[model samples]
Target: MTESPASKPVPAREIISWAFYDFANSGYTTVVLTTIYSAYFVGVVAAELDSGEPGSATLLWTLAIAAANFIVLISGPIVGAIADFRASKKAFLFASSVACVAATALLSTVGPENVAFAVLLLTISSVAFTSGENLIAAFLPEIASNKNMGRISGYGWSLGYFGGLLTLGCCLAYINYATGRGLDATHYVPVCLLITAIVFAVTATPTFVWLRERATPQKLPPRKGYISAGFGHVLTTLSHARQLPDLFRFLLCIVLFQAGVATVVVTAAIFAQDVMQFDSQQLIILIMVVNLTAAVGAFLFGFAQDRFGSVNSLVAALLIWILAIAVALQASSEADIWITGNMIGLAMGATQAGGRALIGQLTPVSHNGEIFGLWGLANRTAAILGPISYGVINRLSGGDHQLSLISTLVFFVVGLLVLLTVKEQRGHAAAARAN
Candidate 1:
């Protein structure tokens, strides 16, 4: 098979800078969505809204997350199409990055009395974060050869885990020290969020300085329909995807399992809080440990992706995820929960890094921006379904988390079955020819 243009290598420094974006974004993901602020939102902000029902805050938090995902799902494609056509990925990335950092920092001011503000800021921050994600991923095709895609993607994910681990470590230490000195965690949680914003800004700077857009700008069609051109890009891809069977098949699998992944990620902290009775300090510690394992998993699976093939690596990771969820179902104690958390880390890193590398390998270099936009769309759809399903189930079951955990297994199992039919090498060849 002939190499796609994306398989051409850029500067090593550019690759490092690109990877650092993952570090930056993970600060928000680990702190706000996964560990501290999510729990803070449910336990502190949304709790005051309904004193009699603990589940109310959890439901609201999930719904807010679902709303943000829906917004991203609707907009990711058009924004991606525009970036591709304009050859302005960095410009859009910078805009989204600023919005996320600013919103995260501003979130420091919101407390229990300001539920609506919390929702508004979260929706904005999540959307901004997602936008940045799509833009950065669009850079992958420009930076690494298909042969190294797995390693590069894996490295980025590993660094993200380190970012998460480092951020969580600091938060855990401060919360421990603060609570020991008689300061309430509620007072300190906002400060932790501010630190996350700073970390995000600082770590993400390298990408702005070093990475360059490689795609030549494509002018929109003359006049009239130009405004809606972005919408047409993804639609055209969807209509013609069967011609690139592997890419299409992989995306379908992503939508299936990634929804499960999204649910597991967003809920892990709150699940610990609501079910396992973990305080902020304990939750941070748990997440830190998970990040440590996740980093290792990303590193190992990335290599495995290159050697064993991305599909095999991803399938193995999904099986681990299935087992992790099963463990979570039986988690009735801290040790049991710890087991679940560690397993999640292992599977999380492997699956995500593998999936990303697989997509990079399968896509034509010219279509990176638009194709990954579809990737983001699939991700956001999962984002919508996973959290909403969890929230609805929680509401229906009176917050029975075990049942919610059980629901995620269907995604992994089904995704794996679908993925079995995909031929990665054939897919890459098809993409190269299409381009």
Candidate 2:
């Protein structure tokens, strides 16, 4: 028996499930990485140690983040390959989700006396969350039609921001109601993380149930040889990408631009607390404002992409980021920081959703997971550099945050230059042939 085609497109329930994972996972980004947990690490965990120590608690946090990025860089391609071969995207998602939940829940045990244990748990959770994101992201093109890909991607991002906003709000409420007069706000960080993990696990169930994996064209290799096969495929894909000038240019632009994006995200909370001296309430407000603006930006840019093309929309977003970061460097007051945060919110959603949609438009279907795995590698590897550069510059310049921010312009400028050389029409043609 053959399946019947419906007049109206089947509602993308599976796609929504895939997207909600972003929603579920974003709580971690907002509550743990960006605002609450970071503050806890620097303020509470690091406070126990001596000031101005070279290998102090702050250094350990930075090293842990770098380590997680490196692990993702190495493992992304192999995981993508395994998912593609086994048609096991959902399975991988489930496993990673569980890992994230377990690690995050464990974070609640971290305290002033157990700083090392806290960082260790956070590192594991961070790695798991990121790895899970890779699997969920790879499922996008399978569920979204080309015409609606940008819009769907926008919705996913919007939902993620909303999720972040919700979690941030809850944290703020908890702080207001529960904390005593003299208690450090940092003590509540682990509780927020634990809540985030529970929410992630609960919300992630629909995705596994609703999403169906598409069959992969590539044959499954023997279990003993799969690792070698995956690596071999990675090398082959890299060679092919080198030969395709447009693809090569796209990847280069992605690396540079995403580095800038990562820098903004990783540093936003730190910048607020350390440089602007924002309190927890103010930091939560700032995060919500940015997240709200990003939701708006994603919708606007997705519409613009449908009309003007992804490349044009992306270039426009990059220009906005350049201006935002420039303003961020000069921002001193809370008002100025809030304005900068809004601008970042505007650019963040567009840059990421548009870039991913562009890749979906450009890549050959047969190589979707492989190509996206490479894209993930570039993103993760770039993450390593962005934070390290920010930390080094911030530490070196007598803790001058502005100088560290100025470094981001290099990424945006270089990314724009490389993007101009790419041929979108050729990429579309390649995609058509693969289909």
Candidate 3:
């Protein structure tokens, strides 16, 4: 007899391999989107465009991010559904990673005059990165039981922040070396992009080699193509929204909170540079501090998640986010920004780890991909909404990024309110019944 998913043994090797994917991919977000390339695009690339609007670079960058996330928003659920039906989550993950790595490496060719080129590459890589992210997350229910999902998920996230730190550290070292040699960003940023891609490729290799695909292929309906079948399955899952009330409710909450999270992820570097007058090295150091704290937060919160419940942990995290935003709004000196960034980092780590764990707990193994696809759908939707909203606010506020940041508070506050409505026990019970 085939083993039930819940009873299936997850080897330690597989868990490590799974976690390594997070380790590998964190570099992309850290180096490209959050630290090096984003600032390069705004300060150097888009500046060459000679756009009269002070916020044009920020707007363009957010548009690129939003555009990529929009693609993921449309395709992520379908991809997950297909991955579940075909038992090809790993294959899909590999494809997405390859695309991301390749596109990221090619970003080295872009120059100050290549605004459109830079945006195109950024969009492609972002799509691949987000898609792979969703695919990897689908592995959670298969590799972990509901009881310890928080701890295990926390392992991946904590490791991911460390990975980001490592990547940022390497890039910072290179930037310092290049700066010492009197090289401009146009000369050095490309190399940093290449470094991020190489690290991503090297670190992610273990996941492809060591991680096992545990999903069993489901029978397809006669005459239906995989794409159509995938859509049908997604629709069928959506049709049962009422049955999984808590899960759906939690997803709604994710949409709101993730908006705040997404805004911070894509725009924090921009804010640091534009508002705080932080140079490249100082900006990197600030982010590295955030990464270290974020790693610690994820590691500790994982245990807290298991002990205290996901909802409670998440509530605490969101409350911290609100507080961080308050601090950020009034931030004046480097000291104030440091405190705010650390607060944001701690809350970010706990929020991300807690949310993913809760979803894993609430999700049935049988539809891990499809359900997490919906989770991805929520995330991508937030990604699209959040950064774009921030950009719009920046534009409207005459390039005042500080004013734009207040919008993040709304997402967290409202999301927390909605989160209070989701009964955690009911969510777990619903998943058990579905299984």
Q: What do the candidate models score in CA lDDT, each in turn?
A: 0.86, 0.76, 0.90
TM-score against native, each model:
0.97, 0.93, 0.98
Which candidate, 2 or 3, would have the higher TM-score against the true structure?
Answer: 3
Give lDDT for model 3: 0.90
Top candidate on TM-score is 3
Q: Candidate 1's residue-wise lDDT over 361-428, tens digit each?
A: 89877788888999999889988888888877887787788887777888888988999999988998
Q: How much does each candidate deviate from the true structure in C-alpha RMSD? A: 1.9, 2.8, 1.3
Looking at model 3, residue 376 earns an lDDT score of 95
Off by over 4 Å in 2: 1-10, 48-50, 54-59, 180-183, 216-218, 221-224
After superposition, which runs of candidate 3 have C-alpha atoms over 4 Å from their true positions? 1-5, 49-51
Which pairs clash in model 1? Answer: none
Sorting all predicted structures by TM-score, with the top scorer first, yields 3, 1, 2
Instruction: Give the worst 10-residue stretch by lDDT in candidate 1.
Output: 1-10
The better-scoring model by lDDT among 2 and 3 is 3
